[model samples]
Target chain A: MWLDILDRGYRPGTKLLFALIRLLSGQPLPDAAKVVFYRPDFYGTRAKEFTHEAMRGPSAWSVGDRELMAAYVSQVNECAFCVGAHTATARQACHDASRVAAVLTDLDSAPIEEPLRATLRMLGRLTREGKAGAEDMRQVLAAGASPEQVKDALAVCAAFNVTNRLADAFGFERLTPQGYEAGARHLLKRGYR
Target chain B: MTGGHLPPVANKTEGIVPDEDDKQAAFRALADRVLNGEGQASARQRAGAFRNHGLAPPLAALIGKVADRPAQVTREDLAAARASGCTEDQLFELVICAAVGHSARLYEAGLSALAEATGEGSPGHVA
Candidate 1:
């Protein structure tokens, strides 16, 4: 069931969603074809470039790390779109199957190092509590993650939140569990999420 | 929640008749998602709208809810954004604006995590 989703084709609504993800992630709805379900009206047009970039490239932090961050954060938020998207990417990156499984099944065991852990933890706390402490970012920086890395991680968290909500909110065009895994692989191989 | 709705945000200008079962099933799933996952009023609103209008449920309705937290690290998405040239401040605005601005609960979590992990007295705690 999960793997089958990988082979499914896109439809109009799904395309719109694709566009929305792109637009929200910073891609533009201006891009045509099936990927426009998200709509710039919701995610805005400004995020286009940023979203486009997420599709491929190395990380200011680490592409593998970024994918994992997204996967963890998305799971924290309980977003299927994000979970599927990031999970697919994570698998492809294949940093560590055990670590990946840990993050997927037990978030407490995420494989990344400190500063990032602090950031993700903070993000999770905020999601649970609705307001993080001032020190979370500080701790992240202290751990050697730059202010920039901290903030970008924030973007990953934020984007995933919106993306997850949107995906879950619609609850359609879902990928199968297998496809979810493959999708992450596609992103990782392509270097985007 | 109802299955289908006309979409309070939309007009009757361009759309479909809507599959009742699909919309209903999707809404039920979405409602479950909010209850079991993140608690967002908008999602509830959508669910309510679904019930109100009688739309069909979506496919996301079938899967079990995902756990709400994580404790591992495996990707470098953050580093990539930085490499994309987003400064700390930009990243800050981008994240906060994106998360909170987009979803209240998610926003709260994003901020809280930052504070807890980076806030004072938490050195090496995250590691």
Candidate 2:
């Protein structure tokens, strides 16, 4: 389900940067990346800035935890492109990639701390149901998560909930395994901005 | 955690960025324009589109489908929107507006839940 928007140089500045990135990497930019480049001045810039702040900005949650939370939300939403890209990023940041994968496949049995698991369950509810109530937050807090960590984790979940819908609705180009790895590396190094 | 109370949802905006208030105001302004401002889509059409999560008639059906089941969106869906007279840019704007609305609701939900848990205020009447 991909939008038919032309994925080429449109804006002068974005076009130049895309060209340079393609030339250096020897690979085309992913549709997810190109989609935002469409209106860099409008919502695109804001979306990117907010994503950076949510995913890579300073927080009690580790980058890995945030990435994993994003991947988990994508998984629940069934956005394959985001699930692949963010899962790769999560794997890179976490001590154990398999654990992340396990959680994705089955959260109940995954080898994760209780607080993070509780938070992830909260995210799942948020994504599927569009709301997680006070009881959910209380459970997470009782599991030992700090309020700051819960807020940061929810921000990641909320940001991805937006991105996942955009990617799916627009029909983002699905990256290959190699492309996913490369994309993950780029995000890890440069961050969302 | 003694004396702890859930902070207001509006206050959490600061945690997202240093200038979150400005950013949020800008986003809300854009959203208002997109959803409520004049455009090619008629006022009725825009309201129905926002409510139904698509434009009108057959197109609204498709938009509703996409809103409900995003993964089911395909080239056919895009082509249908185009055939219904939606330009690429309009389609892009619609998607952003719908998504931003969804995100806002989620943020409010989390904040409300947290506020309730801390016994600070009721979910909707947070203060």
For residues B10-105, write the lDDT of model 1, one tens digit per residue.
Answer: 222234433222222222232233323322224433333322322123211111121122211111323344455544323222322222233433
Q: How far is B109's C-alpha from truth in model 2 (Å)?
A: 1.3
Poorest stretch of ten by lDDT in candidate 2 chain B: B1-10
The digit string of per-residue lDDT tens for model 2 on B24-79 reads 34343444554555455555554454445535655765566545566777777777
Chain A TM-score for model 1, please?
0.67
What is the CA-based DockQ of model 2?
0.43
DockQ score of each predicted structure, in the order shown: 0.12, 0.43
TM-score of chain B of each: 0.24, 0.59
Q: Mind giving the per-residue lDDT tens digits that candidate 2 earns over A50-113?
A: 7888788878788898899999999998999999999999999896789888999899999999
List candidate 2 segments past 4 Å from native. Answer: B1-54, B123-127
What does the lDDT read for residue A60 in candidate 1? 69
| Candidate 2 pairs with clashing backbones | A1-B74, B49-B54
